[model samples]
Target: MSAAEFSYKLRVYIEDTDAGGIVYYVNYLKFMERARTEFMRELGYGKDAIFNHGLMFVVRDMAVRYLRPAQLDDLLEATVRLIDLGGASMTLAQEVRRGAEVLATATVTVACVERAGVRPQRLPRDMTDSLRAARDTNGN
Candidate 1:
């Protein structure tokens, strides 16, 4: 497991909040997803590159805990880390925070799947190697 973490920050908009102006619980997962995507992009294997290799990543499992509420216009930071890397799957630990306050945390397992049938598949060697490089570059 690598200790490297990537952080993405964004402001909650009115559309991201409930009628009461609190962020919807499920939206935290969306924010985590965006952070994961950007982490992959920063690794140089963006969506297009993954698809070109005949594979895509899909969430196979997730466990999330919500600790607090975030209101509209709150600046939220989502941090993502690769906790486990495998031939066919990657497990990520993510946290959503507002300044020093931790609002949500999750552990997500993502599996490599065939782009056509969406069936489980081994991750490309290049991707695995690149992820290792990315981890090292981030000072893991």
Candidate 2:
């Protein structure tokens, strides 16, 4: 990652909106999740790889604010940035923007846990280092 490492962009689809044509509030979380997945993919680790290690990522907490509304077919961009990474948990700052207008913002905390009992576990050292490097390089 670098100072310019912004998250990926994803266009909104009709299916992502509500009957009134505005994006459904819950879908913002979906967008954020996708951005996080892509962020990990860019780091050479996919969901399967993480799960194969008997580890799974779960949303521990989140705070979201909706500032504007997005309609179906809008080209929405979702950005995800690491805020903090601890031994077993990490926090992210995520946003959904339509061009210059920020539609929504969220701070999400995720924890690494064993898939079975959902017990918290330390993230792999290499993975943790990689996330830290991304955060550092991205100036997040």
Candidate 3:
């Protein structure tokens, strides 16, 4: 990916903060997840559609680095980039930014599995094609 595409903006609310008025560390994960879900939606495979195909995406692993704390009422933007795609899994590089400053960064690996038993399954060809197209276009 170009590293500049697949982005979404959100406002930090009081509910997303901790007792100290700083954004709770875990809420950054939720922001990144929402961005990823919206990225899929923009590609035509929303959450429901993917689930209807008997496939589900599950986070296999994640590593996050917090550079700074965000507070309530902050306008944050999250960007998601496709880093690697595998037979049954994909890796994404995501970040939360305030203007030009990166507040946090995360590398998330997600696996496609059958909804019944969480068994790994190959991603649908169409879905893969769409993801590749998005990545390629963004990379340019």
lDDT of each: 0.90, 0.87, 0.92
Candidate 1 or 3, higher lDDT? 3
Candidate numbers, best TM-score first, in rank order: 3, 1, 2
Superposed on all Cα atoms, the candidates' RMSDs to the truth, in angstroms, are: 1.5, 2.3, 1.6
TM-score of candidate 1 on Cα atoms, chains taken together: 0.94
Kindly report which residue stretches of model 1 are placed more than 4 angstroms away from their true locations once superposed. Answer: 137-140
TM-score of each: 0.94, 0.92, 0.95
Model 1 C-alpha lDDT per residue in residues 1-140, reported as the tens digit of each score: 44678899999999899999999998999999999999999888888998899998889999999999999999999998888889899998999999999999999999999989998899888889877776656552
Ranking by lDDT: 3, 1, 2
lDDT of 2 by residue, 17-123 (tens): 99999989999989999998998888867988898889989999999999999998899889988878899998888899999899999999999999989999999
The reply for model 2, stretches above 4 Å from the true place, is 1-5
Candidate 2 deviates by what RMSD? 2.3
Clashes of each: 0, 0, 0
**Lowest-lDDT window of 10 residues in candidate 3?**
131-140
lDDT of 2: 0.87
What C-alpha lDDT, on a 0 to 100 scale, does residue 70 get in candidate 3? 96
| Model 3 pairs in collision | none
Q: Indicate whether candidate 1 or candidate 2 has the larger lDDT.
A: 1
lDDT for each residue of candidate 3 in 1-140, tens digit (9 for 90 to 100): 35436989999999999999999999999999999999999999897899899999999999999999999999999998998989999999999999999999999999999999999999999999988888878342
